[model samples]
Target: MLTDVRKTDRLNLMDQRGLRTSTWNVLTPNAPASKNLLSEELRKNKVSITGLTETRLTGCGEERIGNSDSLLWSGGSTRRNGVDLALNSLARKALLLHEAVSDRLMKARFGHKHGKMTVIVCYAPTSNSGDVTKEDFYSALSRCLATVLPP
Candidate 1:
C-alpha cells in the first residue's frame, strides 16, 4: 500500500480514512542506514514486494542496505547499479549470477522457478564521451539485441 514513494528516501502508506498506514525511511551512505527503519516501514505498510531504480551504485558488494524485515531483496547503489525483487519465498529460491563480458560491461541473470532472465548492465559511452558516432551506437545496440533476437 505505498501511497507515495519518492527519491529523497522516505516512503509513505495511507489508508482511505486519512489514517496512517505505514512509513518507510532509510538513509544511504555517510553511515549505515538503520535496519529498524525499513523493518518498521514494512510492518506498517504490509509491503509484500517492489523494486528500486536509479540506485546509482558503482560497484558490487554483499551488504544489507535496509533492515531485514523491510526488504526482501536489493540491488544497485549510488552509481548506475540497481536491484530487483522477490519476497520471502522468492528469496529462498533466488539465484543472482554475473557474467563479465568486459570491464565496462556485464550481465546479471536471475534464475527462478518461473524461468531464467538477464539484465545486461553496461557502461555504454555517452553522446559526448569522445568522437563516437551514431554508427557506433547502432552497432552496440545491434550486439545487445542479439540476446533477444533471432540469429
Candidate 2:
C-alpha cells in the first residue's frame, strides 16, 4: 500500500493509517475508455477508495467495474455534473451504506473494526456559473450533511 495517499493539502487532516483514499477530477466517466483508465489507475495505486468528480453519467446507482471493484455514482438528467465513489474489494466488504445526494454530491459509509467512517464526495460549480447556482449547490450539500446521524 502507498504510505502517503493525501497528495492534496486539503486532505492532510484525514487519517493515514492503512486506509488509502484518493480524489480525482475524471472529466467524463461516461466513456468506456475513461472508466477503464480509472480502474487501471486504482489498481496500480492499490487504492482502497477513490472519489471522482465530473463523471457525466446519468442517474444514480452502483456498478461492478470488475471482480474486485465497485462504483457508486450520481448524476443529473442532463449528464453535466456527477460524483462517484469507487471501492476496492476490501473496502466494498466494509461498506455500510451509500447515498447519492445529487449530481454534485455523493456519500458512502464504511464500518471498520473500531468505528464507522463517512466519506462525502462533491463537485462545486465554477465561479463562472451564476451565484444562484452556487447557492443551490451549497444548500443541497447542507441538506445532505444534515441527514447524516452521528455514530
Candidate 3:
C-alpha cells in the first residue's frame, strides 16, 4: 500500500480501483522556475490533489501564476514559520483545518468532494543537530497527530 519512487523516471502508477482521488506530497521549492517542472509532471500524471510539506512559503498572499489554487493555512501565531494547504483550485469543499505551532501538530483537511478525502501534512521540528533529538521530535509528532487522526 506504500512505496517510495525514485525521482529520475517521473512515472508513477496509481491504484485507483477503490480510490477516486489522490494526494501527492512533495518537498516544495521557494523558487518560481520550479513550477515549470511540476506543472508538466502534474498535467502528465493527472494528479488530482496535493499535500505539500516543507514548502518554504514566505508569503501568504497566494499570488502564484502557474496554478491558481486557493491555498488555506493555519498560520503559526508568531511570524513567518507555518504551513499552508494549497488545494488545486477545482477542489470544492469547506476545509476543516487547524495548526498548533507551539506544539508538534500542523494539519489541514479537505473533506468530501467528488468522492475525495484530505490528508493531514505536519511539519514537525527537528529537535537538534543530533539523531537523539530528531528521534524525540518524531515521537512527539506521532503522538500529536494521533489525536486528530480518524479512528
Candidate 4:
C-alpha cells in the first residue's frame, strides 16, 4: 500500500528545531486589558511565537506588548477577520522580514543557520462563506507562498 502526503501534512510534521509556535482564535483582543491577558497566556505556555485570528484590530501596524514581546497585526478598515503574529524577545531578533498581506493573511520571515523560514498567518474563510470570498483567500495565499525563499 502507498500513502499520499500533502503539503499541509508535511508542514504539520516538519521539525522546527527548538522554536515554539502556536495559533489561536482570540475573538476580539482590541482592548488593552484583553491584550495583556493574551500576553500572559502566551508567557504561561512558553510560546515563542503565535498567530492570532479575529483580533478585530483595524489597520496595519506593530506594537510592543508585555516587555519585549512584539505584535504585528493586519486588519481591514472596518476591523473584521484580522490576523496577527506575535513574537517574544528571542524570536523577534531572528525576524528577517514581514508583510501585512491583507486582513486575513500575514507573512513573516525568520533567519536560521541554514536558510530563511516563512511563516504565514491566515484566517481562512469558513464553510458558510461565499465562494468568491474563499477563492480570494486561496488566491492570495498562493501568491504569498510563491514568494517564499528556499530554505
TM-score of each: 0.36, 0.84, 0.49, 0.86
Please write out the lDDT profile of model 2 over residues 15-86, one tens digit for every residue: 454788999998877765666667778989988899999988888888888656888888889889989999
Weakest ten-residue segment in model 2 by summed lDDT: 1-10
Query: Tens digit of lDDT per residue, candidate 1, span 31-147?
Result: 344444443554456553333232333444333435443232233333433332212223312324443333233444444334444445444455765566445645655675575
Which tens-of-lDDT digit does each residue in 1-151 have in candidate 4? 1111112111211246466899999987877687777778888898888999998888888888887788989999997899998888766767766888999999887765556678899999999999999999999999989988787
Winner by lDDT between candidate 3 and candidate 1: 3
Q: Which residue runs of candidate 3 sit more than 4 Å off their true CA positions?
A: 1-28, 36-40, 58-67, 71-84, 92-94, 98-105, 113-118, 122-129, 149-151
List the candidate numbers ranked by lDDT, top first.
Answer: 4, 2, 3, 1
Give the least accurate 10-residue stretch of model 3, judged by summed lDDT.
Answer: 1-10
Which regions of candidate 1 fall more than 4 Å away from where they truly are? 1-60, 69-93, 100-104, 132-151
Q: Candidate 4, 60: how far from true, in Å?
A: 0.6
What alpha-carbon RMSD in Å does predicted model 2 have with respect to the real structure?
8.2
| TM-score top scorer | 4
Pairs with backbone N, CA or C atoms under 3 Å apart (clashes), candidate 4: none
Candidate number achieving the greatest lDDT relative to the actual structure = 4
What overall lDDT goes with each candidate model? 0.36, 0.79, 0.44, 0.80
Clashes of each: 11, 0, 0, 0
User: Cα RMSDs of all predictions?
Assistant: 12.0, 8.2, 10.3, 9.0
